[model samples]
Target: MSGLAKRLAGQTAIYGVSSIVGRVLNFLLTPLYTGRFAPAAFGIITGLFAYMSFLNVVFTYGMETTYLRFANRPGTNRRDLYNRVLTLLLLSSFGLTALLIALAPTLMRLLGIPPGSERYAVWLTLILGLDAVAAIPFARLRLENKAVKFASIRMANIVLNVGLNLFFLVLCPDVLAGKYLSGLAPLLRPLYNPSIGVGYVFLSNLAASAFTLLLLGRELLDFRPRLQVTYLGPLWRYAYPIMLMGLAGMVNETLDRVLLARWLPEGFYPGRSSLAAVGIYGACYKLAILMSLVIQAFKYAAEPFFFAQSEDKNSPRTFALVLKWFTISCTILFVAVSVNIDLIAPRFLTSPEYLEGLPVVPVLLLANLFLGVYYNLSVWFKLTDKTYFGTYISFGGAALTIALNFALIPVLGYMGSAIATLVCYVTMAVVCWLLGERHFPVPYPMSRLLLWLLAAVAVVAGSWALPPLGSWIAHMVHLLITLAFVAAVWLVERPERAFRRTQAKAA
Candidate 1:
């Protein structure tokens, strides 16, 4: 790998330490939640979070990307830019948060939250505000290449989030019930409210977001709350399109969950309420986190790295190589997880009820793979200052996602939602690449990437065709298949050989 690629990889590794570990810790909560809450109840968590995803986009309004874009420019005053972005975000976050909190009752009714649980809306809104306030500081960390500090704060937040979840959802309830530690029940009685039930999940998240902001004290303290119109005008123009794109992108990414309960016809799953179906889909969706985790870590590193390298003459080749390797890495994850999901699902789900949604996992994983590619391809527009294209493409994808969900959910149940996600992302990635070729023209090895993707899918399909065997034997067979796929990939994409060829050409 070249120095630029190595730098990107190293940064990704640092970010991955926090992202992978933090997300894995968060991911571990799946079993805790599934064990504690029924599918119907878990669906409430799923649906609320899907809405928060959209709200989060609106809260920050894409200032994070705008900060990176402007801060990296020649003669730019990074400090001033950071302060302006942070100030704008803080102002907007507070205003939006108050609006949401004041409208909590109406929001609750619209979201189908049971009456008297307005706390859920309030807590989620607070979480969004806190996270939005912290967004610029987090982006500044990336801009400064402070990956270690970034990872540390992220890890701390996840640790606290997980710890509090266990405390509120497990220890407090168990102590109050006299299940164990009866002596501590009196001490915990003030904190333990059984009536709150799943509201604790949102409460835990709220506390964690606040803690993350606190840990970013140094970054926040550096702010002077400046808002120069010269900067703000351009920043607004650059960022609003990104915000629109992000909102529409969230529609593609999460609208399925938000719409599933309402759109799924009655009696579709027999004995399963629409919420129960959403819960099942949500649980299975977690199985795709490995793919997303890789993409996220890549994104953290790639965004800043791509902006920094935009001036380089060789950037297009570098970008193409990066995408090639990124696809390879995700393809490996897709196969590894899909083939062993039988073993993995049971361990994480604990409840047999959720296993029914297992079939959606591979489809979701593949969708995320395409989403990652879209993220990579999107560099062209960001670098070219043509972000309006992103807005257009994302809104187009969102329309497709909504149309497909409406058309498919009633017929195929939650599986329809999964299929819709896959189709939407695939379409967005292809459309972005086609537009990019005309405008930016990176030599992405489309044929090879597609071949690898198809091969991985075939491997997963072939794994399903294997005859039933003992649990241990089946695991062995799947392990061999995974290993074989990895070996084949290594042989074909030998980095050392490519590096030597590049050196020879240079010589």
Candidate 2:
């Protein structure tokens, strides 16, 4: 790898420590949740969180990207830019939180949530506000290459969240019911309310977000609340398109969960309720986190890295190489996990009820892989100040997602939603690449990328076609299949040869 790629990889690893590892820890909570709550009950958590994802996009409003973009410009005052961006974010977050809280009951009713469940909406609103306030500080860390501090803070928050979850969901309940720790019942009784139930999840998240904000105190020390029109005008112009893009992106990403329960016809699944389908879908969706986390870590590192390298004449080739490697890595992960999901799902899901949704795993994995590609392809627009194209592409994807989900969810259930996700992301990536070539062309290895992707799909299909075998033998076979695919990729790419060629060209 080149020095730039090495730096990007190193930064991705640091961010991955928090994103991939921390979220894996967070993802563990799924089994706990699934084991404890029935599918219908868990669906409430799924539905509320899906809405939270959309609200989060609205609350942050693209300032994170805007901050990174403007802060890197020559002659710009980083501190001043941080202060203005953060101040605006804080002000808007507060305003949005208050509005959401006031309308929580009405919103809950519209979403078909039970009447008393408005507290979930209120708590989610607070969480959104806190996270939005902390976003620019987090972005500032990325801009300054403070990956260690960023990772540390994020990991701490995840640990605290997970720890609190165990305390509330397991220990407290077990003690209250005298299952264990009987001696501590008196100590915990007043603090732990059994009626709160899944509300603990929201509380745990809110506390973690608050703690993260506090830990970032130093980043917030210079907040002087500057809102000059001179600064605000350009920032608004640049950010609003990205915000629209994000809003639409969230629609493609989360609206399925939000809509599945409402759109599915009664008795579509025979024994299962629509909410149960949502819960099953949500649990299975966690299986896709491996791909999503990789994409997130890459985005965290690559956004700043891309901006910094924008002036380099060789950056187009560098971008092309990044996408190639990114696709290769994700395809490997997709095949590995999809092929072994039978072994993996039971460990994480812990509930037999969720097994039905397993078919969605590979589809969602491929979808997220495409989403990652779209993120990489998106660099052209971000660098060229044509972010409006992103807005257009994302909205188009959102339309397709909504339409597909509505048309298919009634007939196919959660699998429909998964298929919709795959189609939407694939469409977005293709459209972005097409538009990117016309404006800011990069010589992406389109044929090579498709080759790897098709190869992975074929491997997965072949694994499924194999005759049943003993558990150990099946494991061995899957391992060999994965390894063979990796070896084939290495032999064909001969990355060492490519590296030497790149070096000679640079020299």
Candidate 3:
């Protein structure tokens, strides 16, 4: 492995401590929530978080990336720039929280929540506000290469979050039932509400976010920024475009859940309401979120890694290899999950009611693989200051996403949403790859890469076609098929190793 690749691996490993671990801890909650909550109840929980996903993009307003861009420029005042940016984000987050709290009734009504359930919106509002405030502090850790600190806080947040979820979803219910604390039941009566089932999920998240903000005391309390109008202008100029891209990209990422309740026709599925369908889909979506975690872990490392590598002449080749390896890994993940889902889901992933939408999981996994490739393809635009091209691509994907969701949700329900996700990502990935090659050509091992992808896909498709056997027998077959795909990739890469050796000798 090259030095750069080693560094990338190290950084990715450190960052994964948070991204991967945090996600796993949270992923564990999926089964717990799915087990206890009905499809509609869990769907409400999923829908609320989907809104937060988009809101995080809005609340941060691209300052996360903008800070990175300006902070690294020569002769920049690091402290001043940091203080200035943090101040703006602080005000924005606080103001947004106030506005949402004041208008909770109106906004919750617009979101189609019941009149009595408007407090969920208020809780989510506070959650997003605290997260937005903490955003730059987290980003600063990444910028400073404080990977350990970053990972620590992230682990803390995940542990706190998982612990709270357990207390609310598991212990509280047990306590109310007099399972352990008969005497304390009266004291906990006000804290626990059986009807407020999904509210516990939001409440846990709000407490977790607050704990994180408190941990970053210095960043939160810093108020000595110059508030320079001059600095603000350039940052906005660079950031707002990224913000546009973020908004559009988020639509591609999450709009299905947001719109499903409204766009999914009345009486589409036999007994399930639109929100119920959302819950099923969202629960199944969590099954594929393991792939998403890998993609996210790579992103937290790769975004900065790519920027730093822009000056290296051999970077294009390195990036191409990175894409090849990433595809191979994602393929392995998809096959592993798709094949063993039966064994996995029953054990700890989701409940029986949420299992109905399990078919969408494989499709969503493949879609996320394409999305990962698109992020790798973004090197050209980010390096060349043509990031606005990203905006255009995201806009195109967003349009496609919205149009397809509108057209298909009524007919196919959540399955339509899954298909739309697949199509949108495939389009975006292909578009970005083609355009990036024209503007910033890389010697990508496209042919061999696709061969590995196809092999993995083929093995997975064959697994699907296999006869149903006993549980252990089925798992054995799945394991063999996945291993076969891995071996095929290794065998194909073998000759390339020899060829590289030959080239090295010639040099």
Most accurate candidate by lDDT:
1
Clashing residue pairs found in predicted model 3: none
The ten-residue window of minimal lDDT in model 2 covers 497-506
> At residue 209, what lDDT does model 1 achieve?
94
Shift of residue 438 alpha carbon in model 2, Å: 0.8
Please, what is the TM-score per model? 0.98, 0.98, 0.95
lDDT tens per residue, model 1, 242-306: 99999999999899998899999899888999899999999999999999999999999999999
Per-candidate total of colliding backbone pairs: 0, 0, 0
Local error of candidate 2 at residue 406 (angstroms) = 1.7
| Range of the 10 consecutive residues with the lowest summed lDDT in candidate 1 | 497-506
lDDT of each: 0.93, 0.93, 0.84
Clashes of 1: 0
- Model 3 misplaced stretches (Cα beyond 4 Å): 181-187, 218-223, 494-507
Ranking by lDDT: 1, 2, 3
